[model samples]
Target: MNVAVGCKVRFLNDVGGGEVIRIIDKRTALVKTFDGFEMPALLSELVVVEPAADELLQKKTVQEKETAEANRKKKPKSEVEYLTDDSPEVADSSGDELSLDIAFVPSNISNLQQSTFDMYLVNDSTYRVFYVLSNVIDDNHTPISSGILQPDTKVLVKRLTPEDVSKLIIMNLQAIYHKNIPYKPFQPEFYDIELDPIKLYKRGNFKRNDFFDIDAYIISIASTKREAFIRHLTDKAIVEAIKQKEKPAPVKEVKKPNIETEEVDLHIHELIDNWKDLSPGEILKIQLARFETALEGGIKSTTTKRMVFIHGVGNGKLKYEITKLLSSKYPKLRYQDASFKEYGFGATMVFLK
Candidate 1:
């Protein structure tokens, strides 16, 4: 049977089942096992468990909620995981069993202009959350407000700008917890979260909130926390990187004769020292090779705006060959007779564009 990503499937050879993460090809697929191991297996080696992933995802969410609620009564005070700002968003027991979900809801007024997106910090577990919201602006963290969020309650954290939506910045939440049967309160925890820019603008990202009676961006801080990694670079290096990105590449500069030489000489003797033993055909070949090389070099250069190739008035053969090559191969370059005051009718001046 043909399978697609996000479908639930069981391994034919193994006793375990998993969700299909990716369709590698016609014959292969990447499966994410229930035990969290992702492995590539042949399509024939898999059997469809659930064609729709939404059912599986809903079942998993309900199971987690039941588990979190059951742990609320029997959770130990000292038993806790070292929670950090940048970590996976797996809900854990902190003696009193607390779980927080940070969700962003966008304004969905049909004709609304410049939406002021709303952010909600929800307390899912049975404990009250004392929360503080801070905004990171211009490399500085500014405190917005602090309040106590009751159990199974949510509070508006802040309104976001479109500029803020596109950036990496998000509200930093620091909070302590409280419970009626708790031995001691849980320590303050840090969480960094931001709505995905691509998803934030999408109409599907927001759903009709029966509670709020409007549409909003709902970001779940349930399964994973955004990483708080920063890159360190010197000012000079940053400036150089910006310049490289914004600036177009410059043309290479070519070497040219000074005012004394006036033009490049393509004569056989000027091209090579040992030309006495060389045949006339070989001499002509060497002169043409040197002339082609000089012409290409001048064309690639920004400094050499105009250059003259002195091939001499020898039977007009060399001149005719150079003209034909320029017109056919190097059609972009315009060539004509050199200045009458300088080389007279012998040299050709090639204009480099």
Candidate 2:
């Protein structure tokens, strides 16, 4: 194979085509093409192909090259995945996972007046309604919309059948009522509503909200509620809240000591003298305290600036606490490890908002 620079070759596999740029070894050659790509190809993979005189084989224009470079420099947009179908699990910062158990109900049950209500079916015999009377209501009933429920309108709810309850659970009807129903709890009250005897014996004591209970009763209603109820007491939310609560507060950057031209030697000697007397821990503590003071000052002063915490490399406890505090308290600010010479491994820099 006499493939040399400028020789055209078609790759044996679907490796595409290129022009030879450098002969690497007896069996390998470097190829550079009009697409601005370079790759190594084995001699067996390349066939000595004749070049076509078409404009497609020409070198890229300066504008095209600039566009290609800009495109290469562009980064993909960041995405946050709140929910996924593959796994019904969500993770928090503390690495805990949570799942949602959702139930749906119909939108058209007319007699159901409460925006939210809890039902307790006792002994599979009695249907009791724990009615939470709120200002929220639907289009048909705007009792609370005028800031008061009409004294004449008596709000009543009926118990649903077993089949209706199953449909509500399957459809996740609570989400619909929560999103669509307009009711605010002014003085919520609980009441019990007994269903017919046949429905009570078949379905045991199942707890559900009024929207879900009513939707289950009116199965003929056709609206679909697509929201899922997120249990607030999950491990993930609790863990995250705990972490945020426990994390350390942000440290503010110190303004470099105002050194006039004549003060350079004095400043140098002061730094040197301080370094000689202070142990790494002492130096770190003093620096951390200074940063804290500066941070408080910045917040109080409403002045935003960069602050550096100078803790020298020994154990990184001070550094860790400083970073944790900044992340937890002032998450909007930017933070990073300090420069190598400034604090070695122990110091951190923070940009305050």
Candidate 3:
């Protein structure tokens, strides 16, 4: 009997059983009980429970439940043994091809414009395969479904709302397969599908497929005996890293560029493009603003020991104003006359604190 994940099954010898949560191998599977106990059991020892049987089991009374449990085989617990990968039964296959696809079947095919989707994974091959479907955004992988798919089986993985379908981004799938018996080695398959959210709304894009009855949008990651596409994961980033690794070593003593002096020309003409029509107050304001900016730079700079401010020896108003502001707002800074030979005593030098 072929089994897949999420199949409801019951223990043949035990009184009760649970749904199949994982397929361990061809002959072994992991079943989760109603009480949340997950135990390994052989596929042969567990029988699939139909939907009707589940309803009757739920409605059964305490006495009826006990009677049902008593009717099961009274075999000892020692008789149960889960098959391992090395077991003879784990060997089996679909000949050569192991294909799979991510399908999105519209809920209302007639009205595809406003319909939601029922997302599913279709394993077209005859080999039982394990798959993980996830969305990758901003380098983070979030799982949507992680389970085993029986050969030639399609499982409903998610019910996508219209909003979810609209914001669809890149998705990734990873899979590994096992057979009913030993078969030739097969490599793990991976895919990074860049989904076009707009395609889901286009009625003409949906085409008939073998796995689903409706015209569903399908993304085949693996086909025939090999992968349908290639993955160049972060190749650009890796190339950049290699380029940095191969860079030449720095010089033994790299010479620093000469930084002669830090100077500021607070002349109104240098500060603004069109200032001839401005008032004296506005003109002084612009000059003072330039002075404050230069002062801050001198104070914060590590290498600069001093800064020169060309206030010009016009009416000494600019010089007096600079001194007064420096004394009041910046007590740590000291000011003195700049070089009389170079600036004709027009510039003032401030000793950066």
Q: Residue 301 in model 2: shift from native, Å?
A: 3.9
Better of 1 and 3 by TM-score: 3
- Most lDDT-accurate candidate: 3
Q: Candidate 1: misplaced stretches above 4 Å?
A: 1-97, 109-113, 166-168, 183-187, 207-211, 222-353
Encode model 2's per-residue lDDT on 107-218: one tens digit a residue.
3333233222222111110111121222222212221101111111112211234453432221111111110112321222121122233332222222343333243321
Instruction: List, residue by residue over 1-353, the lDDT tens digit for candidate 3.
Output: 45556678887876577887656667677777775545566788888774334454445545445654663446466664322232333445538677777889998988876798877788888677777778888768898666667667676656677777777667778888767554555777766766667888888779987876689998765675433221222435333433343356677987774344578887777666666655444556657767886688778888888888998865466888899999999998788899999899789989875
**Compared to the true structure, candidate 2 yields what TM-score?**
0.20
Angstrom error of the Cα, residue 157, model 1: value is 2.0
Q: Give the worst 10-residue stretch by lDDT in candidate 3.
A: 226-235
- Clashing residue pairs in candidate 3 are 91-180, 91-181, 91-182, 92-180, 92-181
Q: TM-score winner among the candidates?
A: 3
RMSD of 2: 30.5
Worst 10 residues of 1 by lDDT: 222-231
User: Model 3 scores what on Cα lDDT?
Assistant: 0.70
